[model samples]
Target: MIDHSIDRDPARPDVGHGHFRVDEKRWDSTFFGRQIGSLSWTELPADRKAGRTELGRIAELSDAAGYSLVECHVGMTDFTLISLLEDIGFRVVDSRVRFLTRWTLADVPVTTPLDGAIRWAVPSDRDRIVELTHEGFTDNDKFCSRFKNPDYFSAGDTRRYFEAWIDSTAFEADAASAVLEIDNEVRGYFIYQVRGEYEELPVVKGILTAVAPNSRGANGHLAMQAFLYHRLGLSDWFLDNTTQLTNTPVIRNHIRSSKRLDEIVLTLYRRPAA
Candidate 1:
């Protein structure tokens, strides 16, 4: 089943006006009365007290629903709420560095050759995408369980999301999406968006990128770099990809590749039922 917990609530005006939306379906889960699992709030106002109250309510709901973990992204410079979350038992789960490599008109690098072929994905690629996603995430037990289990998102629901992404005109126009295929089999994919208008400080926001476990080493990285070369050229631009602190390989790869600039830490909170 697709979780609609984080979607906007039409009945509540406050929910739609802000950049944040709470997941009501998740709220109804057993985590509501004692704990919360993976909650995200974005574009929250700067009012500290109000923010705490709202978060507290969400926590209460999550506790009742039997959730034991929650996660969110906050502005790196926003210390107010970050501190509050820490005080409430949320521990810093990971720190991620945001890096940028720019590309200019004259500096575009030729696409690197891949053992696999890269191509624009169509609706037909949906099943393959879902399969790759499952295989790619299985290394992380928590993520794999959350995504693979029928309680979270069924195979059909997963297909719907992939289909939507494959068919999105916006994704096509941005040129930030593609699938990697090897020997007529889909191996991986990536999705990103260009952020900012100023050429001097443009950012390429990565949405998702994953490669199947069975794919050769660096296939994922090569595909990602090729996409960057194609879209942003060879000039420097800011890009950030976040993963759990436990994911040491991902962090090391970003650092080793000089693809990260600075790391920002965020907490994941949980309150198990009594």
Candidate 2:
């Protein structure tokens, strides 16, 4: 079940605007002060007509609740829902590519020496981690596009999400984090899950990895990832990374390292609540 705490404040009848179980397994949530509603689910409706109709209902409800924005990702197989969403008001924002591999320690490459020391993060490093993360991502194509289009994306909201995640939690639970230090200063960081959500499959996933602003143009991000992957000794894992189609440098790095493309998720956004 999805968390319902986000729905308690300024409560409305469980439907106005906040996290809610839209249906059994399907859920929706409000973010950025309940101005944006996002529909997500563990298993979307299988039948095309049913899927489209269900999403349409969610959109209608969000509109009535004064939501200025709504967004969701429909898998390629659910193109019908995409069309249905477009028919109302949603437009494509960006596409996310999921890469998967049965990664082994042997796959790590030895190249230019990473001039930094990687170590476990401590409570004191929380503020630095958040700052470096924002700096690292500010120039990224994805963040740039989102910053330019506030109606569809909230860059501030994105930053806050990462800030909360990096604020000095113990690093050995479901998720783990590490820092790259150069000359005794934090220059880069990486976050990954130690185990997959599904125990049966057990896939390690690298979630957020980044380096500080001045460190751009260097291979710090890639090097940090390689070091973490080697240290963790991941046997199989997946990394969901996305770059704007025009961001050639990062795209090249992704293609060179990825073993397989799992699926491309199209992000659709609707503005003005209609």
Candidate 3:
């Protein structure tokens, strides 16, 4: 297991208030020494001073490692501290509508019938998921380019992308992912992690979801959502989806299908050489 003890700040009053943990790991050469992962402070109480101190440490390390990018998803309820992050220069790379739909054994909806089949992913599905992910990006040239960019997902970097997802799923299956198949073909998938205590309110943190071009319709979207709700049975869940404000169709869909929970304005700041 990765050693988180080094980053742990014991005296912080909000340390575990909201299931928050200050964890950091070495970044790969691909990220140029920049530690490229999240710091989970969602469970911490909203203390501006504490939040700033924690973020300052992160910013210092990121700068030393030459990492210019940092991304995080905070609970909608943690407004004060999230705003503090913006003041420190970490730009909101993207904003996703947080949506929740309660469920019970009785409230389970019928699976949306589609051309494809849905099932839990296995080791055998890895290659197919990788292939579909790379190919699906082609439908949107701009989207593909972001990944293809030298700073991001370059051509043939599919291995890293796929491996990241695989590793995440292996580490936490409950909140990891589920795949969508069609006639035995892997067409799309969703990656999430179960959070919160069962005794309290349970929530699913949806990290990523994608559908192949051929599967980009209401059927495909509904199928994926249905599968997650039915299989996971998470009563309260949140989906942090990334989309441009200009994308009217998607924005409209999120507003309609998922209740708007919070809005965050992200801005990136580049630090001058120390």
Candidate 4:
């Protein structure tokens, strides 16, 4: 998801004053057919004045290094970076939201899914999962995500992203995935991960989820939530999910389930001018 792998290598102090680093996003580069890079906290300048000058240098260096696109994310309240980002032509493309589930399930009512079944995902379900990945999210969705930006990502690439996400994060420690079956056929899937001691408390994150086009209705979404609430209610882990605000299903679930809005991040993208 958020790629929190920032430069925490004790080599720099405060991510430094006159330093910059752009991590090459290999997956994004290959998927989009262009050199894509991302700026980390290490690249953040000290002040607005330094930011204006340093960020401009970062852009030029990135272009000289063959990066045609660069991305960065900062807290929505970080006005210094926001203004500096705008100075260099970065436009907000996505809003990353963090919704926290404090404890037990909220007092929201959900419709029981008709003929829907849920089970932990197994190796055999890979092919069916891929099939859904390709067909589940379509143009008909209220909104998909950062990957669905047609100006930069093709529909085919978007599907590949979902496939890649599941493949890459499926077996990490404490990761669990569930598949939703409708009428005895696999129609949706979601991944959940728990960090036993992340941030000094057990933290649970909703990694991602997808439902087949045939099952994108209220029943399908509620079924997944029912499963999530069931699992979350079992432990006292600090549960949360970072999703695009435009993702209607998740936003609805947050409101319906009473998940508090804890944080909001703005993801900005800048493409090299042709």
Name the top lDDT candidate.
Answer: 4
How do all the candidates rank in terms of lDDT, highest first? 4, 2, 1, 3
- lDDT per residue, candidate 1, 152-184, as tens digits? 345664444544444443245554667777789
Scored by CA lDDT, what does every candidate get? 0.55, 0.60, 0.53, 0.70
What TM-score quantifies how close candidate 2 is to the native fold? 0.70
Give the CA lDDT, 0 to 100, for residue 89 in model 1: 52
TM-score of each: 0.57, 0.70, 0.59, 0.77
- Assess the local accuracy of residue 192 in candidate 2 as a C-alpha lDDT between 0 and 100: 72
Q: Which residue runs of candidate 3 sit more than 4 Å off their true CA positions?
A: 1-32, 35-93, 100-105, 137-139, 142-162, 197-199, 233-248, 265-274
Which residue segments of model 4 deviate by more than 4 Å? Answer: 1-20, 26-34, 41-47, 104-112, 138-141, 171-173, 196-199, 213-234
Measured on C-alpha atoms, candidate 2 has an lDDT of 0.60
Model 3 TM-score?
Answer: 0.59
**Number of clashing residue pairs, candidate 4:** 0
Best by TM-score: 4
What alpha-carbon RMSD in Å does predicted model 1 have with respect to the real structure? 7.0
| 1 versus 2: better lDDT goes to | 2
Clash number for each model: 39, 0, 9, 0
lDDT of 1 at 123: 64
lDDT of 4 by residue, 86-182 (tens): 8887888888888876554554344466667877678888888777666655444665577778877778877777777777765565677778887
